[model samples]
Target: MDDLGVTVSAGSYRSTDPEAVHFPHRWSDEGVAVQAAFTGAHLLHLSAAGCVLNDVYREAQRLGVAVAGVRVSATGDFDTDTWVSRGITYSVEVDSPAGADDVAGVLEAVDQVAEIPRAIRAGATVRRVPAAGQE
Candidate 1:
């Protein structure tokens, strides 16, 4: 089977607050070695939202609809027991000159075809291999 791969590098610690320069002193002092600039859960939501936004634009173009802007927000609850996401939700707002029915149709089509959500719903197997020089 053909496999697709993506790689990301770890980032240093960062503050959650927009204005803060760094995480609070207490968290920094706790000797947390595996800190990340952003959490994995947040990245998952971002991926979904980004896919939806891009699909919306692509579908609108194909349908000959003029869109001014698109906004999508996604959130999900993580189940501690299962270590998996539960009840993911996303809200989409599109600024367009098209009729309401046309806009709605575009959104619905995008929802059906967004890749990340489709992958999650269909389920994909993930395997880890050691990085070069690690083993």
Candidate 2:
């Protein structure tokens, strides 16, 4: 995540970073840690990582699995000339006290329901509308 990717870590895996943007999280008292530059590309990846991290906690609770931490990393590249995204890929790591199988089940469930990742996977049409006062 140094140059080509973005990472979001929460719970026990979260490293203290005063500069990182923190958001309240239900599973983690310290919330989530965002370590990424403010750029279109980084923001794009951050969206995915953030979604996955949240889903991990959500699914864990739904499945009655105990999760201590979660870290999600997302990476992608764009066609330099056109600036079209090549693709985005992400991985999730969970620190848990539950059995491996239980955690795995939660991860699998999150993968199926993580909204941002699913949206990116299916793609979407973008449309622009002028401001109410101007054309």
Candidate 3:
């Protein structure tokens, strides 16, 4: 991921920034940390990154793999003329004491099971409904 990327990390790599916003998690006591700006493009990548981070922990536990931390970063570009996405690319990292093959297995499972990434891969139906009492 480059400068235009967004990252979400949790567990051992979770942010300690005073200004960082954290979201509640079922697996971690400190929650998840977000390391991106407030923008549409960042938000789009963030959804993928955050989902990956969460899935790493979820899938690890389900597989009985010990994951101490997780980080996911995603980046994308757009066609300036149409503002259509050029697609997003993402990466994942996990800190664990488990065997390499175990960690790899968990990562593979997460890749197949993460919901946001699947939704994006299948394309999305985005629509704007009229605001209350406005239509």
Q: Would you estimate the TM-scores of all the predictions?
A: 0.70, 0.91, 0.92
Total backbone clashes of candidate 1, pairs 3 or more residues apart or in separate chains: 0
lDDT score for residue 91 of model 2: 91
lDDT assessment of candidate 2: 0.88
- Alpha-carbon lDDT, every model: 0.61, 0.88, 0.87
Lowest summed lDDT window (length 10), candidate 1:
1-10
* Candidate 2 structure quality by residue, lDDT tens digits, 1-135: 246688899999896878777888877999888888889999999998999999899888999998889999998998888988889899988899898899889989998999998998899777899989898
In model 3, residue pairs whose N, Cα or C atoms come closer than 3 Å (at least 3 residues apart or on different chains), thus clashing, are: none
Error of 3 at 90 (Å): 1.3
Q: Point out where model 3 deviates above 4 Å.
A: none
Clashes of each: 0, 0, 0
lDDT of 1: 0.61
Please, what are the lDDT tens digits per residue for candidate 3 over residues 1-135?
Answer: 236688888889888888678888877888898888898888998998888888898899999998888888899988878888889899988899999999999989988999998999999889999999999
lDDT of 3: 0.87
RMSD of model 2, in Å?
1.9
Best by lDDT: 2
Model 1 clashing residue pairs (backbone): none
